[model samples]
Target chain A: MSTNTTTRRLTMAQAISEATAQEMARDPRVFVMGEDVGKYGGIFSATTGLLDQFGPERVMDTPISETGFMGAALGAAAEGLRPISELMFVDFFGVCFDQIYNHIAKNHYMSGGACRYPLVITTGIGGGYNDAAQHSQCLYSIFAHVPGLKVVVPSNAYDAKGLMTTAIRDDNPVVFLYHKGIMGLSWMSYFEGSTNEVPEEQYTIPFGQARVVREGSDVTIVTLSQMVQKSVLAADRLAAEGISAEVLDLRTLVPLDRAAVLKSVQRTGRLLVADEDYLSFGLSGEIAALVAENLDTLRLKAPVRRLAVPDVPIPFSRPLEQFAIPQVDNIVASVRGLMTFKLD
Target chain B: MEATAEQLRWMYEKMIEIRDYEETMSRVYLEAKLPPKIQKGLAFDIGAGPVPGEMHLAAGQEPVAVGVCAHLRRDDTVVGAHRPHHFAIAKDVDLNAMTAEMFGKATGLGRGKGGHMHLFDPAVKFSCSGIVGAGAPQACGAALAAKKLGTDAVAIAFFGEGAANQGAFHEALNLAALWRLPVVFVVEDNKYGISVEKSASTAIASNADRAVAYGMPGVLVERNDALAVFTAAGEAVARARRGDGPTLIEVKTDRYFGHFQGDPETYRPKGEAKELRQHDPIPALGAVLRARGLLDDAADAALRARVSGRVQAAYDFGRNSPYPEPQDALLHVFAE
Candidate 1:
């Protein structure tokens, strides 16, 4: 932590672009390519100011050809160049998942280590600004489920910079998912806690380490990305009600920090997985299974609870979308419900 | 660029090898799939053979593979679509490993993770995907890699006519042209995308013409002739290697079998495949070789015997090879 008095608080978007700019300036092998990642400065502002800094060759604006550009990224990575290709939205993965999963993800393993794809696919995730079913999704769980690709979802500006640096430096293909709401975009309402005092120096955050955002003893909220922001708010409000809630942000899903999750739940004795991704067969179930499989050493105060988007598309209506996606109040209420159960 | 006698002889031998391999696979794929081998009342089962699961054979499309691959070098990359054995064999991929991969053996390419459609042999720089139109973009990527790495090695993507209509095909063409990549897109017009005729699926008559929209030259081989494909591919490969950018070549080819091993193919007109087989490119290429004094009866018999030996040995190796351990399925998910 930088204790300088002149510390500047940066948005998640600025921190991401800063990290990319630093890495690009340091490593000539690193470059950026995507639709509007150059002139438009990224739809979520993740690549803002990169085009002017690095010029056109390093910061490329691609045609609206996801498969072509994504495959080109894979090829470039295989040839020993590090490419940061941006998918405008995570929802659009369906159009080019063949290049993503079958090639970029599996090429290293399929080639028996003859080839390595060191690339970062950065895509905007989550729903809040009525981007409907097609545009609104936090499908990092889907990417995590597939083998060979690392999945990183950062909750705040500081973690975004560190994790994006790590993802770029990684020798494997990584999907760096940033929540649109947490990027501090002007058009959408955001959680203020997502803006943080990030250090200007380049740093790398190793994957599979969970951050204990707020220490609590009552119940633990296992979450990630935008839900981490909401969990912090829920934990703050729960303090007023004398219901302490520990918030654990799972920074990366592929190399998931099971020990951090189990240790937190061991002390709190209760678990509530708050996620913005879908409800079924997803992160919530995996977290619950992690706890359930370790019942010999752990005692549970209640059955594990989950707060996630119900198995429906993110609705266009505001109330319906909020109802489907887990919010701060939903996390607070879930914690309150967990407090009701007694071990005896 | 014209193919010399050596190139013509090599193309003829490879076409014969591919034809023999596909015919053998078609027969082997049906060994235990009939009514008696499966449960009662079922006429046929696709998943009950020695080579289980869906099998797509390229019996009548050997000319397309041999013609394109004849101009390729060991360093060049070839990306093939679903019906990929012809491309794999023509690209000099290990016959034993590829066959064993189809049989799901541990010694196979990809260690049996990828089957016939998804063979990835990095040694020969040959790979294929089961997804239609997926290979085009990947081929472009390989070409881009060569260009960036300062190599004259070109790449070729072999796809069916149906893939030409896919968004990936158009996108790859545009990207290849925009970047001036050293790639050649070869469309094997087998006339059907699993029963839907090209007339019904494609709006345009020839997919080669679609190349103009992406600012590339389009060449169409009006017949299923190996020499015609060789000449077109040689020119395209030379153009790509000389940094002339990408080209699109469409070969009017034939498919003598159903889409898959067990496909009823009731959608086809009666005797269409039989009628198409009368102009089989394998014998036609042999006739050309014979006319050019490149082949005699004794030489042709000797070549057939040699090709048959190799194909039979590959099939035997695949059949006799051991299946991978059950727990091995969890391996190769990631590189260490």
Candidate 2:
């Protein structure tokens, strides 16, 4: 929004690293720690060049002890230090989730406002590059299901930088999740528009703000993270076919942009949610329920449709993996199907 | 590390206070469990008493608390496991507030949100968790904060021997040592983790033995002897304050009650808990005081009466306190 700011095309990983670097330089309390974050520069390149700039004390390389480091981060946060802890992959939350859900998330409420836990847990998510069930996952829904945590998933470099900066500054515990497929790493395949022009100066994007990527009126495609790219492609294709489809990228899951979602649904009268998480009792269901709760009030058109991974582990095989993931084809088909749905 | 006559008397009085408080809680909880058809004047109902929910009484583990807390400062932090009443009282948390919390009153430490297991009294830097092996790592964080803020405040984590097997426990020990954080990890080896003996669960003979793996001193003390525990914990607390990192102290004690109130406890040998009461630290320490000429029968009787009166006042305040409105449950879920 600032015309005076300089812009550069940075990858999602670079944007995240720069955001963390700027925040660290700006606030003395902010520090980064995780497995291989210091010397190795992070496996997904999220913390590249941070150690050299901030030194070893501020940018720490922890042991392969998830529960230890995660709990330590929460402990440090409660003591008035802003700790940005990386959990490597969102799939590894199981090893140290007790600290995240019970301690870190519940500290403020449990203390009766006497203690503040300013912590950010940044982790990589999404399945691609043949990472099996263990590594590839988009479990933002799980963290969002928790009450105390703020969940954010960035679809592009610009939003990634902005949201990461905001998460670092926020007082509450935040779960900053990134899709491995959209990090713009050269070794792994990435979507075409994953990397985008990001402002060089530090900026903050407030949570609960939904970005309307492409505006249309026939059907609104609600999605986030890696699925945002596929939704955009699906909307483009739908537009070429004379169908106006709107694409809404939910940047943060916890403080959901309910107004944006309801407004889009009211204008389109058709809803299609594309998610990478599980289909049953998950984000998709929550969105459908949100629409269902307001169906009697909103202008009626069609039942809400959801496109998500079936309830199963992500297979190692590429064919099976792609089949389980919500691809552009699936989004396109789901949107087209909803366009033809008839209301009773 | 020697306790003077004053310190000994203070420890004895504190231990008596804890004993009286826990005994009264047990009595009130059982009275609530009685069938309503008994038609007693007591307004006790099943699961609807002033002090409702799970109550883990620490009637026999007074030495461990009295020993460790005797060395701690108000600025220091202490985290406890499921059975935390002894730690809270030992750390000098407000008894009236703690009682109100146990009674689910708004004036409680956690404002009634956290019953006994999740009590959080930031005023004393005290917190407890029902989760096994969860407090050690948090204690490390508190120590780290103390170090970073240039304060000599140390942290103490009180856990059961059973929680020593948890990964969080191992991680906490390793992290505390690797960074040389000021923390004292105290394992109250009550010999039973909710009806399972320490031998039946953990492979290690003593939870303190695991401290060697983390390059720290491990001390095992006589759990029933308050003076022995006091001496050992004093050294550990001194070592931590001297920037010597953490020390694992295993206090071998016994639980006079079930893991939780009303627990069937069929897993333990019959009469073991009742039999273990003979070694209870309160009477043991009182005997020591008597031998030292620090306390006579009249002095002991007067101390017991005073402690009993204080505990009764706390219980009356809790019983007279009002339960939070149903909607208050949704409050305190997030801080504004």
Candidate of highest TM-score: 2
Stretches of model 1 off by over 4 angstroms after superposition: A1-9, A25-28, A78-80, A106-115, A186-189, A199-201, A316-324
Fnat computed for model 2: 0.54
- How high is the TM-score of chain A in each model? 0.98, 0.99
Candidate 2, residue A163: the lDDT equals 97
lDDT of 2 by residue, A12-85 (tens): 99999999999999998899989999988999999999999999888888888899888888777877789999
For B1-336, candidate 1 gives per-residue lDDT tens digits of 777899999999999899999999989988988978798999998778778888999999988999899999999999898899999999999999889988888878877777788787777888888889988988887887788678999999999999998989999999999989999999999999999999999999999999899999999998998889988999999999999999999999999999998889999999999999999988888888888999999999999999999999999999999998988878766555
Interface RMSD of 2: 1.6
* Leading candidate by DockQ: 2
Model 2 residue B106 distance off true place after TM-score fit, in angstroms: 1.1
User: What C-alpha lDDT, on a 0 to 100 scale, does residue B124 get in candidate 2?
Assistant: 88
lDDT of 1 by residue, A192-281 (tens): 899999898888999999999999999999999999999998999999999999999999998899999999999989999999999999
Give interface RMSD, every candidate, in order: 2.0, 1.6
